[model samples]
Target: MASSKSVLHIITELGRGGAEHMLYKLLSAMDGNLANHHVLSLGSGGPYAEKIRALGIPVHELGMRMGRPNPMLLLRLRGLVRKLNPDLVHGWMYHGILAARLAAQGRPVVAGIRHSIYKLSSEKFATRLVIRAVASLSPSLAALTYNAHLSLDQHRNIGFSSKKACVIPNGFDPDRLRPDPKVGARLRAELGVQPDVFVVLHAARFHPMKDHKGLLQAIARIKDRNMVFLLAGTQVDSGNPALSGIQDDRVYLLGERDDIADLMTAADCLVNSSWSEAFPNVLGEAMACGLPAIATDVGESAAVLGGTGLVVPPRDPEALAKALVQMKDMPQEQRIDLGKRARQRVIETFSLSKVASDYLASIKMFWMPTAGDGPKDVQEKEFLVHVRNRGVYQLAGRSGWGRADFAHHDRCGAPSWPR
Candidate 1:
């Protein structure tokens, strides 16, 4: 039966942030186009709006001015909510969470907390105000979900409610992200990286939070001249003054490219130097693409790795350099084995279908209204671990990972992951 329930997603913006990517993935991965989905962004929808629209979903932008609150945003959001009358409203990040809470009007509203509260000082003043606001107002929301277990605890320490909090890790499509030899070759050729070079990919915008300088120091320590660093993200190119110290001939700056999945294909490793994160998707993405990773010990990074890659302390360039050398020195067979395990970890635990099922289950737990039955059906049919010990990963024609409906995998049956 077509579910009567529709979900409205509210976010600060539909930029390329991890939260936006996850939201897009969630809606796209819904089985049978399950629940009717709509999105409202407080700012311009940005590049991702078109991608989400391509999925037959509608996206609304409130044109809210960033770095400052727009009081009228509430009025616009309230009107939109009344018109759409969604069965549930889900908010992403602090700004969107409070806005959703204000507009829900006693209806079921769930908030998503995607950033790690590593320290209160890490938050901007505007966001700090929202965090404080939510501290008192979170109880009104039906439930709150943290992308990382660490984020949940950190927020609780800062006086956010723990009474109705849960963790739902981000999900990925192994099929879409797995290693492609041809794609990798094409990417390397396009980037002018030599066939013999050991390529390490770093993806993050030019922000102090990313600690790009730490990574540059680590790269300097790597003795191999054949080593190449492919830097991506907004303003991560040589023209950025922050990267002026990077005089290595092998350093290739790709300011911002949409085909990150293709770049992941060509990468020998993915490095994340973020000082704080909730659930950094780049490491998981690299793993999904069958590449080893070296990431700082930020929010859920080590956890996300699942022993599939190396994790070092944040802001430690020496340790990161050592890890790089270790990776470069490892035998190709051993590295390949690690890469295989990395891919397996993503497939087993973080596949888009599995995480989507968990999300749907959480929604069911929060609100039991009969109107919200579409995702409930998906949770039962596609994400089941076992089928009478026949040993399969997902049901035929409903895996929810991609357009393909009948893909299956062989593995011992486990609750969250069978294969």
Candidate 2:
């Protein structure tokens, strides 16, 4: 067997967000026989660091100061790269991509674009310069969603060919998520919600892009008194202050709980009103837990849902309210069927195994054999000869054959094949 390859993955932080969660999933699902992995966080470690560390993968917290660029940070990163000497450097998100590309020099760098173009701009010229620099320096870049790939084209316009830029969707582990009736009951009871009350859940950080205000306005427009909205996610003070008022009897703002899977199960439906998204993981998680979703038709939402959920136009609370009402009146059997289809779609197309394989295949392609490395036919013959010499073919038939008596021995010695 060939020696295992080393890959270093760099990310902004180990935060509890979609990109961070996907990074953890990818690292955990990586084939140990193929590569040894290491992770570095350019920003401070958060909730995800512990879980990543628990996976026996080395996690480094670079203790980077937020909101300011330090030249020494790049030097430190380069030092890490020199010490680790990874065969490949995989960067996630913007800052991580910038730092990793600079540190990798001319080494193979895979930059992961996770968000939309609307989210890429910065008022600071330095940040934009860094982004452009990274885009120029990266030998190859990968987008987590098709929208992200489009976003890259619209914004940075990094002229890398299609072969150098590919789309690799996010994936989820169905087993890590399960529907817990007790969790739903406990959350409902804690919020003083009646047993019969219908809950619409929105689990996302209180960011301006998430459009929580629009969701709240839609819920306020609902005429039904029995309907409650469960808002669970981190609350950022930087976002619109008006969203803070959403905390009321009908709208419960549960800030950043670890039991999101349980909350998805507890809710009548999962709601997403994001102004933009590359590929929201909440929709996949909700579907995996057999919960129907209602989302704004933004950033591959419709594609991800695949008719398993309802979609409304962004920033339209009236339409959102109408959809909510429609979903509320939907037959229980039909809703369950939709949820099953959602889960099945995720299983078939977005499982962690599938995503990992796609990434591995892409990486292999990125490292294509150079001239004088031998042709495909020669490589195949060499591989077969190695297997045969190792006695792997003895089990192919009931009886083992002598080396000279093996079929196609002459073919192995042909000029087209490697010696």
Candidate 3:
């Protein structure tokens, strides 16, 4: 038996968002015999820290905060990376990519680009700078995995390395997220929602990008008193001042929830109103629960639906309202059939086990061979071998993986194949 390789995952934070949840789900689905995993958060560890720890994986925190960059953390990160000496360093987002590039110290580093970029100027000044920097440094990376094909195309258009880019959409576990009428009934009873009332779910953190205001406006356009919208995520409760003036009797603000699967089971349909997204995890989770969805045509949303649900233009409240009405007015049997097909789509296309295996395969491509097994001189060289088109390209140069040397080596020789 071969020894399990080490993988270090660095993310912007450990918050309860799509990226965070995906990381947790991926870790749970991955085969432990192949690799040992460790997670490092550039910012404070949020809800996911303990959840990840529960799986027996070590989680480290840098104690950084939003809009605040700490230079001292670089030294700490570098020291930690050196200490871990992981076979692969996987950065989860733009900030994590920046940190990974800065601290990898000639180690192989792969990046996860999780968001969509429609326009560069629309981004904050700081974020724009980071994007430019990441783009400039992208050419030498061993690999760049995107959660959506749309995100990969958008980033590549903005100068990200197309050669190293690949798409790996988000995955869902049907067993954990499937429909349960009993659980749905229990949830509705607890929430005081009548069995006949129509429930529309929008589960995402309260952020400008999520466009909670747009969702609220769309719900307001509807006159159906029996229809209620359930908003669930971090800071998405009644206490949020931004939502105060618009929220009404028909709107239920559910603060951060661990029982989203139950909520999905209870809801009649899911709505994703975000103007931007790479691959919204909640949509798939809702689908896995056998709930139909209505979403904006953003970042693989329509593709995920695969003709199973409704798709509308982004930031269009009237269209959203119309879709809501359309979904609500559909015959119960037809809607239930759609929900069943949606669940089947998730099972056949986005099973967590299959996606986790893809992730593991991508990671292993850059895992270096044991030192003595490779040629002595080649073992001493600090570089990552990227296999593309049957050729091996050196991914890391002297200072960083900022330059690539397209030199193919015999697969049977030293550093024959990545372990």
Q: What is the C-alpha lDDT of each candidate?
A: 0.78, 0.71, 0.81
- As a whole number from 0 to 100, the lDDT of residue 297 in candidate 3 is 89
- Error (Å) of candidate 2 at residue 402 is 46
TM-score for each of the candidates? 0.87, 0.82, 0.88
Q: Can you list the residue pairs that collide in candidate 3?
A: none
The whole-model C-alpha lDDT of candidate 1 against the native structure comes to 0.78
The candidate 3 region of ten consecutive residues with least summed lDDT is 394-403
Local accuracy of candidate 1 as per-residue lDDT tens digits, 293-379: 988988778767767778899999999999988888888888888899989988877889887876765554433433556644433
Give the number of the best model, judged by TM-score. 3
What lDDT score is found at residue 27 in candidate 3?
94
lDDT of 2 at 230: 82
RMSD per candidate (Å) reads: 7.7, 10.7, 7.7
TM-score of 2: 0.82
Q: Using lDDT, rank the candidates from best to worst.
A: 3, 1, 2
In angstroms, how far off is 343's CA in candidate 2?
Answer: 0.7
Model 3 TM-score relative to the real fold: 0.88
